[model samples]
Target chain A: MPQIAQLAQTYASQIFWLLIFFGAVYFIVGRGMVPKVLATVEARENQIAADLAAAEAARAAADADEAAWRARENANRAAAQAIIAKAKAEAAAAREARLAAAQAKIDARLAEAEAAIAAARDSALAEIEDVAVEAAQDIVRRLAGAKVTKTAARAAVKEALAHV
Target chain B: MHQFTIEPVVPFQFAGYDLSFTNSAAWMLVTAVVLTIFVAGGLRRELVPGRWQMAVETFTGFIDNMLEANIGKEGRKYVPYVFSLFMFILLANLLGLLPLGVVGIHPFTFTSHFTVTGVLAAISFGIVLVVGFWKHGFHFFSLFVPHGTPAVMVPLIFLIELFSFMIRPFSLALRLFVAMMAGHVLLKVLSGFVINGANAGLGIGALVGLPSFALMIAISALEILVAGIQAYVFALLTSLYINDAEHLH
Candidate 1:
């Protein structure tokens, strides 16, 4: 093979160039560039982690705000309910007081009407007795041509009303 | 044979040694330039990388993972050398297989030459030896003696293990060189059949040329796979060897 035949002649050049080029590759690529790339990877990872942590903090804050808002809303609802119940109880008490005052006035007026009716009835009875006595005396006097006394007639009318 | 021949582009000699700039050397230069451009494009340092940056990271990450797996945390120190070695071989192998011959450019596979592969393997082996001696001193020799051996059999086992250990560089060189050279030779031989049969007659062309052409296509695909696999094997073995040196196991 030409490889073996030319080995003695070509080995030196090949080895020399190989070393020179391989050394260049080692220094330029391996030593210089690799570390930079790895650093970039690490930086990206840290940035992502930081972003995620920030998002988590924001979420927690939002949840806390919602919880506080919910508690305030519940307190306000309870306050409104208590105010409504108090207003309802006050209205009920006022209505009961007004009804009791009206009942008392109605009872007083009914008693006064009954007393006035009793006095009118008593005066009307006395007037009827006087009329009856005058009519009796006038008829007796016209028939016998004599006058009648009012006191005696009144006493006689009273005895007759008692008997009737 | 002509494909394998080395012709000097610029002849030079220094100190009684011929180190002429040859086609092989030119390709090595091309490999370096191409690799530089590839890595340079990825140095944008954007947090969100583009496709080019991603491609570069994929390769570096692959090597990093391999080293971490094989040599543990200490393997981090050898990243530059191992990364360069893997990328150089991988690019050189793939560049050789580029279908540029149609444009009258016959790309040389430098890895096909034993001298180039031998030197690469020597470097890896050298690192292993230096690290082993430096870290463990005389105790590095005990790597040859497996744990829990019979006292009488320890010497024999040690000799055998030493022989295998010494042959590592040679084996590494031979494996890459043979794999590259054999694939190219087979492709060339099959192409010869396709040309010869086509010249002979249409019937012979249909019979021999057609099948050879089909086979060349399949083998070309397989060669691409082999190119990647060989590069990976070289890097993996090197890392494993470094592991042994690091821990002396």
Candidate 2:
């Protein structure tokens, strides 16, 4: 074979060039470029990790803000409820006082009206008795043609009124 | 065999040596230049890599992972040499199979030469030897004798281990050289049949030439697969051998 025949002649050149070119590849590619590529990958990974951490921090801050807002909302609602309750209580007390005062005034007026009615009935009975006495005396004098005293006529009228 | 002949492109001599710039040396230069361009193109170092960068990264990462698996942390230091070796061989193998013959440029597979492969194997073996001695000193010789050996069987086992260890470089070189040379020879033989059959008669051409042509196509595909497999095998064995040197087991 030519490969075997030419071995003695060509071996030196082949080896020499192989070493030179292979050495070039080793230095240029392996030492020169590989480290840079790996570094880029590592840097990218670190950036991703940092971004994720930042996102987590922002999310936590948002959650804390929401919690604070909820607490404030709850406090304001409680304060409003207390004010409503106080206003309702004050209104109830004021209404109660007004109702009691009006009731006391109505009771006094009702009592005065009752007393006036009683006095008017008493005066009317006394006036009716006097009239009846005078009428009885007149009737006696006209029928018998005798004069009758006021006191005796009043007493007789009283006795007859009583029997009647 | 004429395809395999080495013709000097620029003749030179130094210290009584025929160190001429031959076709083999030219192809070696081509492989180096092409590889450099491929790698340099991918050196954009973008956070998001393009297809070219991805291709380059994939190959480098492949070698890195293989070494990491085989030799652990210390394997990282040998990445450049192994990566250079792998890409060089792989490109040389594939460049040989390029159907550029129609354009009158018959690519030479320099790996088909045993001398070229022998040197590559020697380099790997040399590294193994250097690392073994440098790290473990003379204790590296203890690799020939396995642990828990029967006293009577020690000599025999040592002989066997020593023989196997010694043949590693030869085997490495022979495997790649034979594989590449055989594929090319087969393809050449089949093409010969196709040409001869067609010259002889239409009947023989239809019978032998047609099937051979079809087989040539199939074998060409197999050759491509063999090219990749051979390169991977070389790198893997080298790393495994280095592992032995590093750990001495």
Candidate 3:
């Protein structure tokens, strides 16, 4: 066939061009273009990874801040509680001291009043003894139709008062 | 028949070698220029690539995956070579299908020529052979020797394996060339029938012409598919061969 016959005439140029063109394509595409594309993809991946990491770090920082605030709040509450407890103790102590002072004053008044009562009782007893002595003397004179001495009547009344 | 003709534009001869710039050579140059522009233009560093850039990326990825799958990650180095072969063949096939065959200015049926396919095949085979030897040295001969073959069957198996290895290039080249040539020829023949039928006065001629024209359209679609398939097959085999060379056994 002419096709088979034409092979010899055309083979050289075809082969030459094929090598040249194919080699050119290989170098331009393989060495040049491919690396750039791969780099873009890699760059994107790295950027995404970095962004996610930053977000996580920010979240962690927020958590730490929150925890610190809560701790501070708890510390302040505890301090307030301590102050209230201390004030209560101090108030109780003051109340007790005042109560003790009032009791001391009342005790002193009670002692003075008891002393006054004892003196009054002694005076009253002496008055009653004199009255009794007079009565006894009058009665004795009427019965026996004789007069008794003041000293005797006084001594007799005293003895009767002592026995009663 | 005229499509198969290779008319030399600039003729030269040195030591009995026909080193002429033929129509085929012109198309090759055209293909080279077009491919360079495509590769250069598609080089965008943006994260979101444009259509051209995406196409370029997809093309590279396709070859990359093919190499990795067939030949392992080390096969990555052969991406450019295999990618070039695929694009070159694919473009040549598609260009041949264009209506430019009438003017003959663009001799686009370059891939349909056996020499063109043969050269590509030979190059792939050469790489396989050279790399096999270079990587393995004298031990590359062991590629033909089947492991676990009995002593009695060793000679037969080795001869068969050696022959199979040698014919790989021819098979690759013939498969592509024949498919392309046959498709083009059939399309040509069908179109001729349509033209002849429509020219022969009205009624029955138009009826006969319409079906042939319809059949040509269907064949054209099929040819486009074939062009893609042949290109893929050529590149896929090249990668596979490279795999065999690189990994051995």
Which candidate number maximizes TM-score? 1
TM-score of 3: 0.75
What TM-score would chain B of candidate 2 score versus the native chain B? 0.98
Interface RMSD of each candidate, angstroms, one decimal? 1.2, 1.5, 1.9
- Residues B121-188 of candidate 3 have per-residue lDDT tens digits of 99899999999999999898788887898999888988999999999999999999999999988988
Among incorrect, acceptable, medium and high, the docking class of model 3 is acceptable
Indicate the residue-level lDDT of B155 in model 3. 87
Best-to-worst lDDT order: 1, 2, 3
DockQ of structure 3 = 0.41
Question: Which portions of model 1 miss their true places by more than 4 Å?
Answer: A79-164, B139-142, B150-152
CA deviation > 4 Å runs, candidate 3: A39-164, B101-107
Clash tally, candidates in order: 0, 0, 0
lDDT assessment of candidate 2? 0.89
Model 1, clash count?
0
DockQ of every candidate structure: 0.56, 0.53, 0.41
| Shift of residue B29 alpha carbon in model 3, Å | 1.2
Clashing pairs in 2: none
User: Please, what's the RMSD in Å of model 2?
Assistant: 4.3
> For model 3 chain A, where is the 10-residue window of minimal lDDT?
A33-42
Scoring the B chain of model 1 against the true B chain gives a TM-score of 0.99
